[model samples]
Target: MIAYRNAIQLGDWIVTTDNSGGIGEKMDDLVAVPDQITARFATRVALLEQWAAGAEPVAVLLHNFSGNASWHRYCEGIRDVFDEIGITMPPISGSSETNMSLRQSAVAVTLMGKQKLESSESTGDWYTYGTPLVGEEVLTKESEIASLTVLDEARRTGLIQRLWPVGSSGVLAEWRAATGNPDCDAASPLDVTCSAGPATVVLLQIDKEKLPNAKRHFGTLLHALR
Candidate 1:
């Protein structure tokens, strides 16, 4: 397997994996949220990474450590995201740890997708497609979270030259990684160090000439990174 960004290339497929822990309805978990929500957001992060890299997900492997009772809720969360993206849910399979009682929730999602070769280079200026949000704020600022439908629309319309979902490393770190400019965080408009939680924000590169159209398309969800 060859690693490209967070995904790995295996034969003709690209695979990406992400995991979450300690944030569920379990008594000893760090955050008291539903297992479904925890699984949903965790799955969202991995899925966003796959989609941003231009992969069509075909399979999912879920790792559940929360207990047998939490398995259905986690699956529900996984399905919720698939429904949001309007894709027929892919085949899902995984394992659950039922031998020992766990104090916290732990889950992992791995997506395997087909890779499509890019014929041209992406040329454009960078922009942010959502605000940075984390923790309890993610629940409270639901509207600020980036929408998968919007991302799909932008990609279909050729408005998004490239896409990068922001994770726990926050916007600045991702911006630097995306641009190969380690010191460019000084120019960001949002909190450079704030975690985006479950990819609540995405970095988009669009041609400057198309900014108006993109702005019109994305509305308040888009913010200039500069």
Candidate 2:
């Protein structure tokens, strides 16, 4: 199974989570990235997860594992997201890794919501909204991964047939999961293999006829499955 997914199917509703790791640890010697950014980071992923699951968010859960000392600070970040959206912060819960003097930091946020994604009767062609970036690239090109502005516009426009977030397994793995076709290989214009630790990019399934909608949102960044 793909390690990172937009959301998992569960009846009419769905569940999803998005988390950040070494970035926060690296950004904050105090524990995690400024909690507000952490909150946004988690919420952003959760939103994509919700869309991938084909639903809307209802509840939330967080695993604030970025060392114990700055737990409250981390939470403040999460709260900032909910407040900005004008939605009551869902009933929240989390854990802090205390007692262990871990040198690095990590954090996880989960969201639960409802909506049927789509019928599985037919799967569409695969495309990518953004190119893959990981490791040092994720750090160097921080703005690209951090913002979901493009994704939000695409989702709101309802331009694509389906959506999935690229994760640790990278684009190639996610494409296989979506199409269930092994032996799928070709020189790709996009880096199909990179761990998008926090789902920095999304997997888009759109037919060629609707390519314009995809293009309007993603511009030259769009990559088709070869």
Candidate 3:
């Protein structure tokens, strides 16, 4: 499916859902992970998805696979993100795998937001934000996943035409699906072969002339796409 901003835009609001897979087993190995750490990452992904739709988050819904883990810890994780970003979180609710025990933990996070389409700007060239991170990299390098801005800078810059969070399918895949250009060159200045899993990185479409200004917010993380 076409991802990020394009796949979500519905009327004046955008809703996006992201999944953090195999929690407590692969990505969420309790031994190496903290209770709120995964929750922060999960919350970040939800925000990015909402931002991609040019919207500010209004609510969050989670679908968790219990797998012997505490639902309270997961909720606390999401709460941590709200505290850090200084936004009162909306109602949070979802179903858990209470019927059966599982070997691994997982979560499906959904975020809802509203965007004023009437104030939208013109479109621009497509670019990828942050580096591609997938597979073992996602788990091994947890710091990279939630280390970017939550949309304040992007909105202020007024350069970002739109955004697409690179998920398990990676940057190249999401780009093709979003733009659908058969001749869309995959060769990029940054690594595009990895998967971000949740939303470690994203596809940013912006005007070429404003490329320099984008760095003011994204720093060295932004990669240009031809």
How many pairs in model 1 have backbone atoms within 3 A of each other, for residues 3 or more apart or on separate chains, i.e. clashes?
A: 0
**Global lDDT of each model?**
0.84, 0.67, 0.67
Candidate 1 pairs with clashing backbones: none
- Candidate 2, residues 1-226, lDDT tens digits: the string is 1222456776676778777665554454443345456656667667777777667677777776656655776677767766655567677776777767555567787888877455554346777766676656655676666236566556666667777887788878877876667778635686778777657777777767778767776876677777
Can you write out model 1's per-residue Cα lDDT over 188-219, one digit (the tens) per residue?
66786889999999989899888899999899
Q: For candidate 1, what is the lDDT?
A: 0.84
Question: Which is the leading candidate under lDDT?
Answer: 1
Off by over 4 Å in 1: 1-4
**Model 2 CA deviation exceeding 4 Å by range:** 1-8, 20-39, 67-69, 79-91, 95-102, 116-118
Candidate 3 at residue 218, lDDT? 72
Q: Write down the lDDT that model 2 would get.
A: 0.67
Model 3's lDDT to the true fold?
A: 0.67
TM-score of each predicted structure versus truth: 0.94, 0.76, 0.79
Question: Considering TM-score, which of the candidate structures 2 and 3 is the better prediction for this target?
Answer: 3
User: For all the candidates, what are their Cα RMSDs to the real structure?
Assistant: 2.1, 4.0, 3.7
Q: Give lDDT: candidate 1, residue 140.
A: 94
Q: Candidate 3: which pairs clash?
A: 24-28, 133-195, 134-195
